[model samples]
Target: MKRMIAALIVAGALVSLPACGNDDTNTETATRTSNTAESTTVQISSVTSTADLGMIDQAKLAAFVVAFRTAYADLSQDRDDESIQEIVFSSCNAIADGATEQEVTKEIRDLAANDGTEATQSQAEQIYKLVTPACP
Candidate 1:
C-alpha cells in the first residue's frame, strides 16, 4: 500500500511539474509533493546493517527525522516557503554532523519498503513527537 501511495505521489509530482507554470499551482504541486513524502512510510532501522549503512551517527539521524517531520507539517499547514526552507534548515545540523540527504533518503525508503503502510505512518507520527517534543 505504501508503495502504491508513493507511486501515486511520484506520479502527482511528475504530473504537476510540467502541467502548470503558475506560482500558485506550483505551490499546490509542492504541497502535494511534500504531503506525499510526509505520508510515505519510513523505517528508522536502516542502521541495523552496519556494513551496508556504515557507522550510524545518531545525532545526524535524529536531525534528519525531525527535519522530515517538520517539512510535512509546514507543507500541510500551507506554509509553502517555510515548508521548503525548514527542510534545509532543520536538517543542517545533521548534514554538518555528517549526514547526507542521500543517506537519509535511502534509509527512509528502505524502512518504507519494509513496513506496512498504516503501521509505518503511525510510527512516523510517534517518532515525530519524540523528535520534536516542543512542537505538539
Candidate 2:
C-alpha cells in the first residue's frame, strides 16, 4: 500500500511537472546534467523538520527530491530495475521519521525557486503539497 501511494504521488508529480512547462533551457540543462548522473546514487540524509539539517539545508533536500524524481522516472519510464529499489529505499531513508507537512512545503517552495520552474511555480507547489502529506 505504501509503495502504491508513493508511486502515485511520484506519478502525479511527474504529470504535474510538465503541466507547468519545462523550458528549453531547463530541459537542456536537465538532459546535460542527467548524462553525468548515470552512476550517481541518491539518498535523503534528513527527513524531518526537527532534524538539525532542517530545510535550511536546501541542497540536501533539493538533491533528494531531484534524485527521487529521477529514480522514479527511470523505474516507470525507462523500466530499469537494476538499482531502482536501492535508489527508492535511499530516497525514503532520507526522510526523518517525524517530518511535517509545513516543513516539506517550505522545502518544496525553496527548491522550486532555483529549479527553473518559476513560470509554473504554483504547479510545482501543488505537486509537493500532494507529496509531503503522503511522505512515510
Candidate 3:
C-alpha cells in the first residue's frame, strides 16, 4: 500500500509538470499573436487626390519637410543644394511610384508647402545637418 501511494504521487507530479509547461507555452504564443496583430494594423494613409495632398496645413508641411530633409541627410554623404534636391526629388518620386497622379501631385505640393517659409526651411536645414552623417 505504501509503495502504491508513492507511485501514484509520482505519476500525478509527472502529469502536472506537462500542464505547467503547456500553460507557459500557451501564454508565450498568445503574446506573440497579439504583437503580430498590432504590427499588421499599422496604417499608412493612402492619398486619393491632389487636392487632398494640397490640403495639408502649413504646420504639417513643415513637419514633413523636416522629416524629408532629415531622411535625405541620412541617405547622402555630400549635402550640397544639388544633393538635397536630388534626394528630395528622389524621395518624392518614390512616394509617387505606384501612386495615382493625384497622389503624386498632392505629395509634391505638400512637400513644397512644408518649407515654404524661411523659418521652416531653416529648421529643415538644421535637421538635415544633424542627420546627414548617419544617412545610408
Backbone atom clashes (below 3 Å) for every candidate: 0, 3, 4
Better of 1 and 2 by TM-score: 2
For each of the candidates, the C-alpha root-mean-square deviation to the true structure, in angstroms, is: 14.9, 15.2, 22.1
What are the Cα lDDT values of the candidates?
A: 0.38, 0.40, 0.38
Instruction: Supply the TM-score for candidate 2.
Output: 0.26
- Model 3 whole-model lDDT (C-alpha atoms): 0.38
Question: Which parts of model 1 are misplaced by more than 4 Å?
Answer: 1-75, 98-136
Backbone clashes in model 1, listed as residue pairs: none
What local lDDT does model 3 show for residue 5? 39
Tell me how far the alpha carbon of residue 104 in candidate 1 is from the true structure, in angstroms, after superposition. Answer: 11
Which lDDT tens digits does candidate 2 get at residues 9-127?
66556534533545876687667555534323222232232333322232233333444445334223433332322222322334455445444444444433332433144533454
lDDT of 1: 0.38
Give the distance in Å from residue 59's predicted Cα in candidate 1 to where it truly belongs: 25
